[model samples]
Structure formats: C-alpha cells, structure tokens
Target: MADDPILRLRGVHTHIGPYHILHGVDLDVPRGGVTMLLGRNGAGKTTTLRTIMGLWRAGQGSVHFDGRDITRLATPAIAQAGIAYVPENMSVFSDLTVAENMRLAARSGAIDEQRLDWVFRMFPALKIFWHQRAGVLSGGQKQMLSVARAIIEPRQLLIVDEPTKGLAPSIIQNMISVFCELKQTAVSILLVEQNFHMARSVGDTVAVMDDGRVVHAGTMADLAGDEALQQRLLGLSLAAHQ
Candidate 1:
C-alpha cells in the first residue's frame, strides 16, 4: 500500500536507567522518502532512534515495521529485518582498511561488485581510500564510510543519527546530495538531525520533538515556509540557519 507507514511507533516510553527519555512518542515514517526528526538538545530524538533499533527497550507501548510488530525484537533481529542504522559516532573499524570494513558489513561476507561500484560513485573518496586504514581518514571521510557501510547492500529502511555533526558546510552539502539521491531509490529514511539546512534539503516529512514527545508533524515545506512555527517548535527559524 502506498500510504502505509514503513515504521510506526505508538505510545512508546523508554527508560534509560533511572531516567525516562521518551514519553509516549507516536511517529509514522512513511515509505519512500526521508522523514526528518528535529528538536532541541535533550529532546529524546536520539533515544527514539535507539529504541527503534532495539538499543534501548521500550518500557511500554509498541513498535511496528513493515506492518509487523517488532517491539520485542533484538537489535540484530531488527537489523536483519532490512533496516540499517548509522549512529552519531560513525563507527568504522579503526584498524581495518575501508574495504575490509565494508566487507564486514555485508551479511554474506562478500562485497557485491555492483553495489560497491554504486557506493564508490556516490562517495568517490571511499574508492580513493579503499585500501587505507579507516582510522587515518578525515572526519568527513569517516562519516562517508559509515554511510557507505550501511548501504553496501540494499535495505528497506536507513536510520541515520546526525551524519553531519561536526562537519564543514561543504561536506554537509555533499552528504545532503547523497541523501537526496538515496531518496530516489525508494528506500525509507529516518534521520535525526540538528542541521536545519541538511534537514530542509533532504526531508520530505518533518517531525519535531520537544521534551521526549513529538509536538509537530507535517511536510517539511510547510514548516520551512512558516518561520513562526519553526520558532515555536525548534526555538529558531529555519531561515536563520540558511
């Protein structure tokens, strides 16, 4: 069904040790486009992504992906169900070569030549550093490699946490281009981003979280065009960032 959400969270609550991070977060990530999750610091945006990936278990409520209940699934099981997650740290193997890191990401332990070629085309720097140690790459290149590993093979959903954090504007623009291109492939994306420029550039739908709950949900264009709403939800206008 074209209108069905690729991922859905209903009345979700998450507790990280003594503190409860999410309070009944209800979000729907519609298939085939980037859904940007935006909020101020301490909004539980990252916690929501972690909970969805099974890194943190929901204390209450349920999560559904592809119309199936996945609230209780393990992290690996959630990943095996055609989802890929790129965390904020860009966790590439420091001691391994770029090629080796990518190979490890492949479920079959064999890199698909065609897919590898596509990734190289999207991020030419990866090809340049194919044999270089991942630890030696620059911060931007490491971020690219993290994304490359996630998409080394096909996936139904790609969840990225602040891919542009600490990156230069030029590098962030490049990452945005890759994400825009990825949108054309009909793979659903759930992105938690503070970079308003990157969010507005790649997002089709937008959800704004505040104090562990989603306070706004609508098309990105609507929020982008309404400065007052942006100020009210995110504390600053998207225009100010542009």
Candidate 2:
C-alpha cells in the first residue's frame, strides 16, 4: 500500500483447518529488489506465501500490494493484480510441451515474442527444449520453465518458493545469475528458500520466520556477516550451512 514496498503483510495470521500456521507475520518486499524469506521447516514460510496469493485465506490482519488492499481478493484477482507466484513444486504441465506451458501462462492468449526472447536469454535450455514435453525435461529445466512462465508477462512482483531445491551446484549458480539480472528489472521478488548459499548470493534484504512469526528483519549483508545473530535466529550461521 505504501510507495516503497511492493508487498506488505502486517500482523497476518493464517489457519489451515485446525492448525494455526501463522502468528502475526510482518514482512515487506521492497520494490525492485529481492527479499529472501528464510526459516526452518514448518516455520510457516510457505503458508505466508499462500496467504499472500490468496490460496490460503488469512484468519486476521491485512495484505497490501502496490498500494492496494488485497487481503480479501480471490486468487485469480490477486494474480490479475500483477503478483505472479511459482510454488515450490515447480508446477509445470507434464503432458504439455514447454511452449504450450508458456502459452498457458500468457493471459492474453498470445505469447509476446520480445518477452519470450528475454526468457530464452535467461534460461537457454528452455529455448533448446521449447518443443519438447515438459515431463521429459530435467528437474532444473522444469524449474526454469516454471520461472519463465511467471516472467512471460511484465509483472510487479514475483514470488518463488525453493526454486533451487533439487538443483545441482552449477544449475543453482545459473539461477543465481538469473535472479541477479531480474533484480535490475522492474519487478520485485519475495523468495522463500532453504538453500542458504543461494539466499546469501541473491538476497538484498531478509526476513527470518520461526514458529509462524517473523523474528528478524534486516539487510542480507548484515545477517550474513553476523554469525552470532544468525545462530540465535536460525540455529546455525551461514558459514555452517556453507
């Protein structure tokens, strides 16, 4: 809602059936930069993302995006508001070719050649396997397609979850480069990742979650250099993870 952060969550609480997953999460994804959401397993990081996307309704609090209050908007409406989400599963259509998958993501029903070229530049393998079935592509390629689909259109925000989950070191490095390039673009990013190495590489800012709440919010450089603070918040320093 503010002019700075493209996305803002204040005192957000979410419940999935009987489980209360989030307890007053406060986070901000500043415009035109990458904000890493770091936390341990079951820390409600995924739930927080789902809540923002309207996949899971927040039980209380508010979600604001680009100067609009989107807390009650439906998933389709939320996406229409220029927030693109790539879940942790890398949800590409297995039965469809890479081109087909990309076409589906284009809301206009026609792929933009210029945007396609940009995507191809970031992930060259997508262009190589453009006509191949998505199921036939490797895990890294599928992940690339998923990301390419999200960026096919010009968007204000891109939220990705664990993009480097099963990728090799080389592929992870490629992704790091892609994200670095993305940072220069107009879109801001809210990335939820457990890969601390990738987090340290691409994160400009950070928010650490624990037991469904954001325990720390600060610049990535500060957190990366302070092993003591890292241990207190994350139980291990970035060096340990490295």
- By lDDT, the best candidate is 1
Task: Tell me the deviation in Å of residue 148 in model 2.
Answer: 0.5
Overall lDDT per candidate, in order of appearance: 0.94, 0.94
For model 2, the stretches where C-alpha displacement exceeds 4 angstroms are 1-3
Q: Please, what are the lDDT tens digits per residue for candidate 2 over residues 1-242? A: 22478889999999999999999999988888899999889999999999999999999999999989999999999999999999999899999999999999999979999989989999999999989999999999999999999999999999999999999989999999999999999999999988898899999999999999999999999999999999999888899766
lDDT of 1 by residue, 1-242 (tens): 13689999999999999999999999999999999999999999999999999999999999999999999999999999999999999889999999999999999999999989989988999999999999999999999999999999899999999999999999999999999999999689999998898999999999999999999999999999999998899889888887
What TM-score does structure 1 among the candidates reach?
A: 0.98
Evaluated at residue 62, the lDDT of candidate 1 is: 95
TM-score of each: 0.98, 0.97
